[model samples]
Target chain A: MASEMNDKNDKRGRLENSISKAGNMSGQNQNNPSPGRRKVLKALAGLPVVGLLGLQVLRKTNYDNKHSLQRQLVDELGLSDLMSSVKPVTASEGETLRIGIAGFGVRGGQLAASLGFMEKSEFDKKSAAGSLDAHISQGNLNVAITGICDVFDLHAERGIAVAQHDIFTGGEIAKKHPVKRYMTFHDMLADKNIDAVIISTPDHHHAWMTTDAAKAGKHIYTEKAIIRREEEIEPLYKAVKSSNKVFQAGHQYPQNSVFQQAKEILDRGMLGDVSHLETTTNRNSEEGAWIRHLDSNGKPKPGDKKSIDWKQWLGNSSYVPFSTQRYYSWARYFDYDTGLYGQLFSHEYDAMNQLLGIGIPDTVVATGGQYYYTDFGDIPDVLHTNFEFPDKGYTLTYSANLTSSKFRPRSIYGKDAWMAVGGDLTVTPDGRSEKYGDMIKRGLVNPSAPMIEIKRGALTASAVDAVSSASTRYYEDRGLVSTNIGGRIWDVNHLHLKEWIDCIRNGGTPSANIEKAYEVGVTIAMADISYREKCRTKWDPVQRKIIRL
Target chain B: MVSINNQKWQTGILVALRFLIGWHLLYEGLFKLLHPDWSSLGFLAESKWILSGFAEWIISNSSVLNIVDALNTWGLIAIGLGLILSLFTRIAAFAGTGLLLLYYLMNPPFIGMGHAIPLEGNYLIVNKTLIEAVAMLLFAIFPAAHCYGLDSLINKRKKN
Candidate 1:
């Protein structure tokens, strides 16, 4: 502008002035006003850039529209509330309940830790390994571990150490309530110091212990299978129901956030007439086959005939020699448990029972034998059990492959869609569907891919582990039954215990109360009886007993 | 200081640079505006450099995170419009430089930092972010907006 004003006679100056005035929409010949058309052209020059960008964005997003399809399906299914389904963890109110732990072994150790009584050595080890999230996330359920009973002295000692020195919640509470070691569960139940009991003993002791605890005026949280034999189901159920005590079965699946999302998907009828649920456990490892006597490096784990009270460990099960194998891995023997049915399938059954409320299958047939790992245990290495709920119009099948670690998704086969549930939940629209038929045909939903995926990663809890072995990862991921609430991944087992404690302190029924536990017990018993007899076992609802045919 | 021998061409090239940078920022703002799920969480979460603690603090609080997100989304849009229309381009350029510098400091591609987020290309200490921030500073120095922009229309300049 300075040059143009000073040297209007120069041709270069004139050229620059004309270009600037025309293209840049500035003052032309300062004394002469610019034309309206020139000003309008310059003012609208930037619009083309924005307009081109908008068109390009539309074209790009259309090509990569998978997210839109997911959004559309989620919107259609009304599953936007799935994330918020995990209600925040409310602190257990009222008096802090005094609880006793019966048979504090491996599962018992986990239960104790989840309840916030993690021992110093164990806490340090987990903290060093960066795996103390279960305790770290669940601070205090307001329940104190007053007594710990175990037949094995080593385990009892470990439990005592855990309950004594483990003071994460409050040092005052820990000091005020000193933990005691009970040689027998009856002694612990007899003591008025104990108000509630966590039955984490072997499957054989669950029914009797739960019954005894209920009779002693104590609330019970029994670990599944809940019963080993068929006769104990009704008695335990009646014992729990007759008493005013709160009973909760330790099946974390039903209370899991993933299961909550799956339940929502089912409740919405998004799957559309689900007729089958395929439950599977594929493990190719020594540990999965109940070879628990040996350590990871194939060494015999601690506990001798002197340190362990073998007679009491045998309990009501028949007189057998005190073999360390039987003592450590009791789930293998028919005298102790139903093996795969009682161990892994019990979780599958309980989850199904809670989700579908399809309880006490009319007929159950179990097949397969101890094809491998036969030298040590009676339980089969490869077992396939089919449970038919004819009235409910669906069949639940469980395939346990101890020798093969193939990834067969635990899926519910629905007519319109299939929901594969695990640590994460995914719903895939079926290629041939009555409900989503038009969606599949219109290319809005790709049938091959999962339309809706809800991933609640428990990175701190269990998702990322140092042991990357397939079986180890699978089991760890399965064990991570996490309840994520407001970006906090809670240990599902702790939530399960929290629910029980809440029921005991407050006046509400837990998710896995007596009714739910009884249904699970019957189903598990049916599967076990069928497996043992090598025949079909039918449930007689009128008699409330399992009959073989 | 640029030579006065070829003033028109210098102004022309500088104006072109302004529009190009303005176009890039405008699209960035528009893309984030269109995607509802787009959040600064992932980027802040991967903050491994100087401002990592601040980044973590932002992420740990949702309210702070929301404020940062809103400021960034709208700030880019405002700066982008200003630069493209050559209206208050110097202030826009300065603000753009400051924002870009903050992003660079949050997750600089220095050796051994090893960012988990995938980038457009492998970068050392001097990445495109640093270069773009420098370019924005140059725009402020050259005053391209006043030479041929809406700023010139509002504040017409002439020599006596």
Candidate 2:
């Protein structure tokens, strides 16, 4: 305060004092130099500080340029395409395609949101909260969710509410669609009003619902571990193939921009003679293990015998008494799902398939036990499965544990470099790599850290699951993930659905089409049989069946 | 020049502070300039407190984000050079204070608002950035740069 009071006076006094010291200087005389050399040196003293800062900055820049392995490797390996702009996927504009959603559960809701349907309540909250996550990409495919089929009435109503949301369709004035609920998906399939059906029902219902939906002339987008049992694979395959219906098996990873980059890295052989792929699922929470009947507050979630049609939910699976355990966490039971295989391993397998294009494995050996979560479902809390692709000399190892939410990244081991891919992609040059030997020896590529790293959203809309993940649920438990579905950014799941919708309208093969679905289906069946039956299962491609050994 | 010899220590301290702050901000700007991939999105994404809404508005728009990013880098560089060189020191000091205040507000050390992004020092609304901003305001009040600043030479030819 004291300094401020005399600020103007001090400035005037100092200026006059300096001019008086100069003795011959005047304020208007711009050409006048200082009277003394010492005074002149004081005025020019800022140059030294500028010099020091410049020197330090140059040193730092040199250090960074020297250690930048990513730049060197990308340039050398011709893998710069990984960092190139995301290849544009054509979202063909067309007439609105009416669709029915089966099973409006957790994944069902996610799929619907990805398909550009946000429940009014959720939209209000998500837009308010994650309104800044621009990666959500605001535009929607010209599609409408007119039908919702769920065994649980609450879920059906929720689905109906979501289907009726019209704000996100370019934020236009509310365009109301007559959304109806079907007690069973079969009824939804029978409706001529529905052009496609999204089968997000529990794993047991997938094969039948997808086959039925296809046979009924409705395009199908069914979620992963498409068929829980070995027998359903052929029928599901034949139905989709014979019906000529656009069957997009439920997987959204391929739509990720990073996935394309990862694929390019593999195609360019940046990894160099990849022999093994390691995928992992780690979770410490009950919800992560599919013990989701109870809410976060330890309260039982909404559902009951009266509201949920148990018989219809059971479907072809053997009748089980009304239990919230089966209804909420059906993935934990052998009757409905292959537990980890259906829930999480399917994503790992799908990611591996999409990256390597390695189809059905020759032999799959599964081993693990219910070492944790003893009070709950029959599925193992710790599981490990291996798929040997003899023809490609490739092996896939999937290790999952429900008790530890540690960051166990999924890695693909190649002779040159091993790539760890998740929410971000990192390709660490192997110390003993044959292909990168010269580079590592010359210190061009560092062996200690990844030479090539593609951070999510670096290329384009990196919406998790659609963007990057191991996937997101098991990746980083922090706010590195978001559930918002609004923005000008490309959401991967939205792109996958758009691809399905486009294929339906324009007739092109979507990445998650029937053939890939069949490969994944057989692989899941083999792993399931190997886990449950305590045997090693081998795929006989000629016979189109897995032979137990 | 009358008080120059008498207030040498005080003026020296003021000049040293000016140079140090200039060096710090200049390095920050230079680092961002060097790392082409560096974006304020990470910092803004984890933004908390009063400026978070403004941060979101910038983040949601890529062009706006780019503009903000470039301005932040260049603004820091220009202010830093100004402070060190004592060239337009008052404008630089005031601008520096505003920029520091933005940093302080975006991730203010207020309780419950400081945990999103891990920071270097702990503070109770008195972090180093806030201190720096106050110090910068001091420069706006005082002509410390006149002791050995390029502004002193220019001021010799004009009114304050």
Candidate 3:
């Protein structure tokens, strides 16, 4: 009976142990499944939100990436249209022309002196010693009168004297006839003997003076960018066309010899398929803005407006209170300037446009702000803008910053090579073996083989091994070489002036005529609109219109 | 377990944002420190129009100006650290935004637009200060600090 009781007790204990184990297993399964279900549900619920966030992030990233990539493409490539069939324009030898300049400002004065020096130097070298004297005697070439037009009475009582006796350098050209002084451009234009007129007035007056000069049958050589508004460009173009007078816009770099050489090399396909281009002008000081300092008395002096017609200065712009800052530094105000875009950027844009063979870009986007000193000025201290030409498969990135002096050397990146123009023309060739070799040698990267580096100068050429490493191992292997090209060959101002003079003397096409000037003006004006709208803008070349994008 | 998991995720997000903004500020300050030539103090001193007459006079004094410059450098570092660690977040954000606003007022982007075409010139519509201010404002408005940061840890301790 006792043995039977022990057996039953042992069996009961075993049964209790199995029951406890089963209970623990069920609890574990329930706890683990609950958490797993929770996780799955949470992940499923976040699908749309996460996907949406990712899409938005991608869009922003692509937008930012487009600029750098496009810049790289445009800078590296050369435009086929820019290499259009070249027609050499040759001028026949003719009588020395008598030229008289009436206005004197930064543009007017600079051009007058440069042209005078160029003409005198060329004449001295090319002509017989007595050729100038003979030309003057024959009434073909004479200094005539080179005096200032004081429409504003800025130069005291005496107009800026053009007579050799009146200037500090009078002795050099003392024997030449004194430049006849005129109080007004109208007075100068009225003289039938005066064959040409150079208008360097404010934007508002550019059209009026040029139109009048054309109507008077005098050739017109004018400073650019032509005007502010598209509407104005049309009228100016029409006026120049209707008058049947010779006209030239002063975008002189096109005539520069160095630029020509660069253009020639680019045309030769020295740089492979160009992909990007970038240009910048960084200025961190107020002087860069062209703000003139005030006089000690805090009053603007009369000489401030020397040779400047005050009324003509007002032109189509609204009348405002006269301040020396505005008078001397007309570029600081919107009424007289498109700020840096018109004054400085126009020059660069013309070069790029001419070189790219692209008209106003299909799209333009700009972002910038003033983060520097504040004064009476009303322009941003820093600005960055991008222009996209989809059809041309290129883009241009431009930046201006006043806060930092970091300067990026302007460059064009091509598929096979890169081209940089400033101090020298650097050509970087592309390939993979060159990059891989550098990486392997560096040990930082294990790549298959060595690379070659070629260095080219104006007269020297040398080849060196390329070390390939992970960091140095560029995805594209290319060799780079540089050569110095001489400066611009043609004087843009002189050529334009000569064209204008030639067109007047012999009716022919001017190099940068009214139509081209108008085109450039419209393009720049649209750029301003894009900036104002904070969106992309497009220009219709056929219709000559700007459409905001 | 659910509460702990949520806390961890939140902490991760807060950490990420703190480092993003904190590092930006810290980098700016450190850059100024490393490159003394990059200092704008001399520029500020030379400014004849922006600063008030009294401020200009004060800045003209070398001893006082030096102290102010040192304070500015350290203040930027402190603000960066505070934000990154989720310590004194409110104060750091406030100060950062304030500095940005001052920069914006100093040079505006509209001035650039007012200039030439291609709209390049001294304008004030877009600038670094404005961008930073917007970032700071976003940070200040969101509960980023509390999401996955020291603030959350502190709160958890308090709850326990």
Candidate 4:
């Protein structure tokens, strides 16, 4: 313990020294022109040439062959027509599911808004509230926000307002459905009127709330990285299973059209025997890096701490002084959250994992430090984690740099071809595919052609406006419903909530169900362990515990 | 000194050339990658020599432009790093030569076909780009830079 304290002291001292040195170096670099500085300047000067060359190559590559290859493969699999007509599988019209929002925070509000409560002005002009109105009018899978709970009075009030349709732009607004506000989640769970709960509380509170809700015979739609620790995962999953209640983890990518198409393309085995998958989370703003919304003075506004039940908000965690920064941006504190692993990489892992159905990795090796966002956060600004799944014959890489957004679209590299997924799905064939000369001659594959790019959804100015300033665009883009359904845009959050609510009403499983959530939870837990312990983390299937290497 | 199997002085000269050309190419690629707004439009647009029409057409087409941009950026970086690090030195030199040759042929510092971009040095149908391509060609022929690079380390491991 003494040595650990000493080590901590040493790290703090080193951090201070480095921060000062970095400041000094910036001013000193121009005059002294150190080797590193010179090298960087030279590299910077050559950028235009390289960018031009890169652009030219991208333009010149003939994608005709690759497109033909995809067409042939997709046609063979009878997915050619389905690819164009792909839509979120709507749940059969059923009785309304009564949803009790346990955590009325940002994500909780977004989820509620997505459930047809968002201010219509926030909706895209073309999308028309993400086509949620039509879905709500369909009456099947309709969700009535019966209860809203939050320790913070402000959050609770805001949630109740949105649910009651008092904060929206609808034509008529005489509260037909008055949503009840609860001070504690337990009260909401006890309300027999509530059929389900959407757990969007801080990372620390997820486990207990989800398990408790399950035990209460209520379905759950929880946020991503459902729990903070590995120990909580099994019990949480089991509780839902034992209760026989629908528990959907909030990983919204499964509702995305591009991802759906990518999955379809992968299912066709077009990207033959995928060996490598790379995903990235990058943003270049304070808001993007979990700094939370700040006031004009650049300091977080201390909320009504007197009104907020701070003790309950802390839950199992140790007590700390009331700080709005901690309450709002809980992601910045290790005591409350799993940092980037749970917040960002969990989404990336779930997206790729959903596409491939590859479970927890054999080993996780991560190296990162709080290099940039050192203001109040313990989480690293830059993180790179590699997961090796030898059994699956593939390696997954997750990299993020809050400092820069230069990485290309995340992709799956396979023997036959590589496919990238972002705003669109693009598949490029490898040169080795030329070995199938007959296929080329038969017009099934184009050896020298460029890649096949499929634009799955349209972008909306409103969508960008809604998210870009919030720094949640990174989160939105990764798993949000960016796909069009029946020529109308779908809200991924809405789709995810609908999936949960639908499953609650009808007997079906959600895409981000408990089983899938466990895999994602364990993977993220491994990443957190690897980063925190500064060691290679491996999962022992036999013991179901993290082993250090 | 002129022996085909081994010549210390000749090898030294080639290694220097390899490193220099590699550094140039690698530096150019890295710069472009780091710059967000960097594009090949001006370079491709100002093509006044042979293949100018083709270059202009490539610029006009969005898909083709994107493809060319990616290829030019990555190809230069790949070839540049390869030459600099002496990892796959011959292949790197060859690829660099090809890129340089294309640039030369596309604009061909030929007399009377004045480029929109200002030239650094005067040339009689041969400019700095052509000269560098020639150097890259020579570097490709004498592949001895691996003696001090990552390739050498790999070779040693294989031998061991």
Candidate 5:
């Protein structure tokens, strides 16, 4: 009986030990897991939590990577107030046209100088030229110049130089006059006297300044590349729309007579069904990149700084240790400028979009990099992009490089004929063979069809005739066509700027208005995104959403 | 697992490919930067293409292009250096891929059809650049850097 009791005790001890071992194993698994059935079960059970944690980690990392710099900059600058609550201002009945400039850079300075000239010229033109100062008088115009809102010091210097040069040289002035230049753009806007402002800063600042100007009830004429980032565009449009002020985007090419003629020709189907459009810019120089050549004496002295506000110069970008590279060569950096796309490509894209009557590209793809110079620049030196519009049945290829001097033919190829303006328009007719001309024309009733083999480049008279005939046919068919095509093409910039001034005087939509500018900005922004992602990007015009490829 | 001869052949092919691609890019970049008279900007500006308006502006301002050229040269040098196991293998591979993509998109192989064979006119889908980029990607993916690089030195030290 004692032996049986001992056996039971031993069995009990064994069972307790097994339980302890399992418990110890589980504890170890809390620290580390061995390959076992229990461990496997634990791992399987924890998978959902692990996946959840992983997803959170991934989301945090991505957000940090993309927005960390922007967040830091925004926080540092205390730009929260600047972004929100844009108050609309109504044009006063007898308010003088108050104008403020966001950037006091080269472009800004020129604009300021031009304004000064305009102020002096207003009286003279009214007295002598009979040129209607109607836009200036009647409380329509007033001038208030603002210093560097966002740009490097060197860029500001260039602006100063340009202003000085304009004052000395003739630029939109009947007589040179001195204009009051302010230290800060905010001060200029806050004065409550300024009527309009011209934003001549880099691409990023254009939207912000324009929005602010509109909020301040100031008319605006912003340079090309209305805005760089996609998100900023809508708010700008809204600000402009809400404030019933004249808004003009600088797209000088459309104003050009040549482009106008080309548009007319395209409308008439003179070049046949346009299938492909290719454009390229391969500038290869330091000057071409718009890097201001800075003086050896680093940052300007305090006295000089007074003349050119340094603090205002380092506007929205990171407050880096002052370097001439940042100031003179701002375009080289992606932070300040959109490089070629915003500065140069914007004009071309806008013109093409206008000519083709396309709103925004359905797909955009870009590829390039800063491969050549070891300079302090972040923007790419070479860029090749394509905007595909499936709805329009066409694609626009844009290429720009700093390296090669290779200039390829930039023309639109159509189904019937290829039209290369500045050169002859070549029209290769369909179904016109040497031997088989009549063979395929079985039962054709029209025998008097003109049999012209390669009609030499259209003469002025012939062009006029062609335009009239095409217009007649178009009218009969209920199509949009031009009857006039022989006049010389005008300078698009001259015409565009004139239109803006005219719109200010006589209420009407500027040639390159808000909607068109937005289209151009969205397309270019999509291209930049596509380049970064190495895939196609699409822009929904109606929704104004950029779909990453 | 692979034979010594096969390894040698693979290494040889890779080296040849690297040299060709690296040299081509390096040469093109150098040629542009060195020749002042021959400017990409001027050519582009003068071209009868769709974006000539902007091309003219870019051509007029070559500072941006100069920066681009400098980057291209360095990128090529880096690719060459990486391929030869000098330094930064992954960086070099990434740059090469980037450069190839840019070139391919700027002027696609299949620009205009109906002139000749569909893909014959200016259409170079599988060009030297695409091939090089692919090779670089492969090298980056595998442990090719260890075969003849500082990676091997680090591995040896660790083993010791």
Candidate 6:
């Protein structure tokens, strides 16, 4: 730290010397303007009046040219307010909420074990090489898991084991209050003991389960891409609203710290008038592309299919030949998921929405097709979306490639400065601001010199790190969870779950509620439709539905 | 240095310098004013100088920005014409110097602040802006329009 300060001081000295040297050579310093030069400036200031009078005579020309310059720059640039703050709703101490786990998939497993059900030290034993140790926080939630449900017995058993503290790990485990395993979501919902149900199932199952849970008078936390079809949206929304249950969408990016800071940055206008924003989600490797892993023998776990209720797992999707790959890697298929739109693009969209609050786009044009990872899925592996909100005078461009892990950190561009919003928010002012005139005149701020880079989080820039490739780690670095809290790591998922619990107790909605998800749902649906139909899509505010353009 | 033989040459050189700089400024202003798409945004945005914050502020706010853009576009034309035709040459020269000073300050060719732009000539603190500003200062101090330019024509008419 001391050395860095010294380096800064040295650079400052050199800059000061350079500028002064230039001033001396110019025969005048900033302290004094030559007498004749000063006199000329006084006379020239009157030219504004003359120009104004001339403008009045050429009113048509003035009017025509008025928007031509300023408007074009802003429009071409797509500037808008980016950082808008939303206060997170916290829970108050009340009745111990009985929660039910649904789906028991990758997302469900993570959520259940992560909610203080699985011990951090025990979970750390299963961590991949170089992964940080999870934090052990006591006095977190006073909630109880009453029931667990999943079509797959393996997932349901695992979720139940974690919730009931039945899982055996390397360390000594303690017994916790048992949670009953429900073979069906309906059975779980039927139990009056379960006050809330966290539906982390496949994309297709989200709508029905959520609506069912809501109708059953249970608070809901459903995963992203909340509904696949347009038909499912209204019913689910009505169900949640009519039942007056707190419905939290599983778009957890809002819980991240960088997004929260982004709101503050936009509020401060530190980046100047934001014009454009670009976000990219890139992933490489077969595993990264939602390919299911095999057991130690490099084969599907023995009798995996036999343990799962295949008919129930298929849900509303058309039935086909039973395959373990289809059940495990359901994300890669269109019948169950919108592929990139549901899995990745939804994340980017919601994160931007959280920061800018631009909501739905005025128009969206989807591009790209199944480029890489083409063998398995009908969905596009590489997708690009250009969302234009003309009234707001900004454009949002989202592009993702599953073939390459080189992700471009999301950024907001302003007239004066541009900022990168990712795991850590970095704000760098545009070099051309007139505020730097004196420094430039002195040659202190070299035109070709590297910018004064400012960063908040330890993550240098949004680059793909193989070890940190897990979605949870990405969210953690992005401020969804605590990277390290006194040597213990915390997950934002836990925080999000805690928030929902708190809100449930206090009779409020979580930060990411149903209403915001509905808006995002429309946009995501439009993106998918636009991609598949090969057309532009428009959102009709009056109709509250997507209109194909 | 102002001997009878050298006086005419000096006056002629000064007048030529005045005309050349004036023409450049005038053309720049007129071209910008005529081109509807022309904006100072890029220049301001691309500014790598010390006053970058001020330049950014100017571009960020639309109202202040429009005024600045208009003032700059018209100011250049006014100063150019004033110098070339010898109408208020003193004020024009001073205005021209001030403008150059602003440009120089915004993108100084200092040791550390080497602009990414490819400069035509080697400069040590004294670039084109400085040279033009110094020349304009000289024009302000010595009114030479009486010798050849329109100011002299006006002076002769006044005498008549």
Candidate number with greatest TM-score? 2
Off by over 4 Å in 4: A1-79, A82-85, A88-92, A119-141, A166-175, A296-299, A434-450, A465-467, A470-472, A476-481, B1-160
Interface RMSD against the true structure, candidate 6: 16.7
Clashing pairs in model 1?
Answer: none
* Candidate 4: docking tier: incorrect
Where is model 5 chain A poorest over a 10-residue stretch in terms of lDDT?
A475-484
Q: What is the lDDT, from 0 to 100, of the residue B105 in candidate 6?
A: 85
lDDT of 5 by residue, A224-336 (tens): 78887787888998999999888999775554333454566567574456778876665655555655545436443222443435455566777776555666677777777
Q: Which candidate would rank higher by lDDT, 2 or 4?
A: 2
TM-score of each: 0.74, 0.83, 0.51, 0.63, 0.49, 0.60
If the candidates were sorted by their TM-score against the true structure, best first, what order would they fall in?
A: 2, 1, 4, 6, 3, 5
In TM-score terms, candidate 4 sits at 0.63
Model 3 in CAPRI terms: which quality? incorrect
lDDT (10s digit) by residue, model 3, range B1-160: 4653243344445446666777667656655675564544444533333544434544434345557667767777766765665555667778888876665554445543232223343444776668777777644644534332344345446868
**What is the C-alpha lDDT profile of model 2 across A1-549, one tens digit per residue?**
888869978987885454334422222255545545645677778889899889887886788777766567667887655556356655458888898998999888977887677788877775655452442454557778899989899999899888887746444434577999987777887799999999888988999888888889998899887998889989989999999889898676777666777788788788888899998888887777778798768888889999999999999888779999889978788888889888777777888898888899999898999987888879999889999988898899999888887887889998888988766778898899888889988888888987877666532223332223333555332212332222235556667888899898998899988998888888989998999999999988788878999
Error of 5 at B101 (Å): 58
Worst 10 residues of 2 chain A by lDDT: A478-487
Task: List model 1 lDDT by residue over A37-97, tens digit each.
Answer: 4555455555566677678878878865756766776677677777776667787677868
- Between prediction 3 and prediction 6, the one with superior lDDT is 6
- What is candidate 3's lDDT per residue for A1-549, written digit by digit as tens? 999999999965654444323322323444455743443442232233334434655675577567543333334333233323333334423543445454455456445533443244434442332222211211112233344454455431232332232111212343454456666678878887676677676555666677677778777777776786666777677778888667887776554333454566667765556777776666544555655555446565444444445566576788775556777767766677766677656666666665555566777777776556567566667778787778877777777665554545456666655555432334444443343235334442222211111222111100111212221111011111112222112223544455566566667876567766776687778777766667777878778777877
lDDT of each: 0.79, 0.78, 0.54, 0.73, 0.55, 0.69
What are the DockQ scores of the candidates, in order? Answer: 0.16, 0.36, 0.03, 0.02, 0.02, 0.02
Model 2 has an lDDT value of 0.78
Cα lDDT of model 4 by residue, A1-549, tens digit:
999999999976765454323322333435655754453443233344445545754553445445555667666536556557366456446665678898877788777766766533444442442333432332234567889998888888878767765323223333446589988889999999998888888999999899899999988888876989888988887898899888889888887777878888788787888899998888887767778758659876657579779899999998898778888778988899998788878878898989999899999999888877788769888889999999999999998888885645778988888888865677777767633445556666565653566664443332343335645555445536455666455566667777777677667898998889999999998989899989999999888888989
Estimate the lDDT of model 1.
0.79
